[model samples]
Target: MKAFYDTGELACVALDAVTGPQVFLSGFPLAGSDPEQGQQFLLDHAAEHGHCVLYTPDDSLSLTDLGVLLRSQQVGAARLTRPLFVKEEWLESQYFRDHLPLEGGSD
Candidate 1:
């Protein structure tokens, strides 16, 4: 709800809500955050992975109403850290490291 966004707690609460049209990740890729930072990345990946939205709150809705709205949205799975994990793996791979020097040095 309004308070959630105002307080910047929507992402934390959305983690447990079911995925569906009703629920959507809202925050954009904030400064110091990666390109895919907010709900859009989560929602797109969730749908790609066969998930659904259960509920969503307006940017200014109250957190107290989350459960009811979520239930009504009937949103399914919640895509939390899946995208981060995928990105982490990519960042950890040799292909990623190939572009960097293991130590500080000019090759």
Candidate 2:
């Protein structure tokens, strides 16, 4: 994708393209933090169409808060993957204890 824009005053620039599924994982100074609207759009469209997992590294909010919003819906799951503090073994144990299916054949 090519984006062309002026450094100063902008001119009318328009282009159209049919793109594939886009995953927008971001954090910022939102004019309004409407988790409900954001969640609804992602759930109704992205998650329903197979994007069940969304990885966000935005530090403005806590993982628990985002997790609650994402999992609030019966359809979507959100995970924050960054500044990972859990040890590998600890993660494995936790995964096995909580998400057994993800443990595969590990006995």
Q: Return the top candidate by TM-score.
A: 1
Model 1 lDDT per residue over 1-107, tens place: 11122234332222222221123334432112222344445455456655533322222111121221111111233222211111222233445323321111122
lDDT of 2 by residue, 1-107 (tens): 12222355331111111121122345321122244554455455544445333333321121221221121111124322112112223223433223211111121
Quality of model 1 by C-alpha lDDT: 0.26
At residue 13, candidate 1 shows an lDDT of 21
Once fitted onto the true fold, the runs of candidate 2 whose alpha carbons sit more than 4 angstroms away are 1-32, 53-107
Candidate 1 ranges with C-alpha deviation above 4 Å:
1-36, 59-107
Worst 10 residues of 1 by lDDT: 65-74
TM-score of 1: 0.22
lDDT of 1 at 61: 14
- Estimate every model's Cα lDDT from 0 to 1: 0.26, 0.26
